[model samples]
Target: MTAPQQGSDAKSNDSSSFVTFSLAEETYAIDVLQVQEVLKVTEIAPVPGVPNYILGIINLRGDVVTVIDGRRRMGLPDQAPTDQSRIVIIDVDNQNVGILVDSVAEVVQIPSKSIDPAPAVGNDQSSRFILGVYSSSDGLTILISLEKLLSDEEWELVRNI
Candidate 1:
């Protein structure tokens, strides 16, 4: 699987590239390989009846892509989008998905040995999505696995939208 390959690649290379972003004041990151692109806040056409985290859809070169609010997905209270807000397009389940973040931070190389397993303290819902925790110069950045971010049922809902 890609997750294991990603780990092995990190171990072999000594570091892995990650695209970092802010969500609810905490820094979080995802493997650079999964990132398609990053965009500024755009007008997202809201879809009815989907989960609250599913912000809506956007036209990306004629492709309708679902955008998810990272904060809402993490069970955090909603906040107003600011000038720094961004939409990070990533590949999930072989489909392109966008994750809205407070801001898109610079990509950085994190050492494989610096990554710690996800702590057991968080609630199950939150912990499941966390791949690991890396202590960086800025602070701790939680690495997320998009594949685990949603369940089969949830992916079905997103697919239907």
Candidate 2:
């Protein structure tokens, strides 16, 4: 089924919106524009020969979406799935990919001024995906760059899927 862009028309004309979610006890976020939909944990059919980060694929309506274990992708210790687990569908290069988050948090608006460049954390691949960090009363939230999340080889694999 086609993912509905719920409340899609309500996006702002000036400010930026982000969909926050938890991963490995830390809060993270992605641009709202890239979010297609949010779904509960569903049965995934594992595909062989793929990276460990890729758990498998799930059939959403008629479309098959690749599911990525967000924790594993971030090099965090593996945790069993729970009731609050959610698959956040996002558009990466126009393709929808599911990020398995521990729990999805509420969306928030962070103006350009509030977004600070991510400090260098060596040259790790995961660190490269961090766009910036936002601070508020709730504490620090890391913003992820979905565009750079996967490497070219990984993207090529996704492309050939």
- lDDT tens per residue, model 2, 1-161: 23446664434323478999998889999999999999999999998888888999999888889999998888788998899999999988778899999999998888677788998883475688899999999999999998778655765686545
Q: On residues 1-161, what C-alpha lDDT tens digit does candidate 1 reach at each position? A: 13445435535657789999998888999999999999999999999888888989999999999998898888777898999999999987788989999999889888788899999867676788999999856789999988888664876767746
* Most accurate candidate by TM-score: 1
Query: 112, model 2: CA deviation in Å?
Result: 0.6
Score each candidate by Cα lDDT: 0.87, 0.85
Question: Highest lDDT, which number?
Answer: 1
Q: Which stretches of candidate 1 lie over 4 Å from their true place?
A: 1-13
**TM-score versus the correct structure, for each prediction:** 0.88, 0.87
- Model 1, residue 4: what's the lDDT? 47
In order of listing, the candidates' clash counts read 0, 2
Candidate 1 at residue 52, lDDT?
Answer: 81
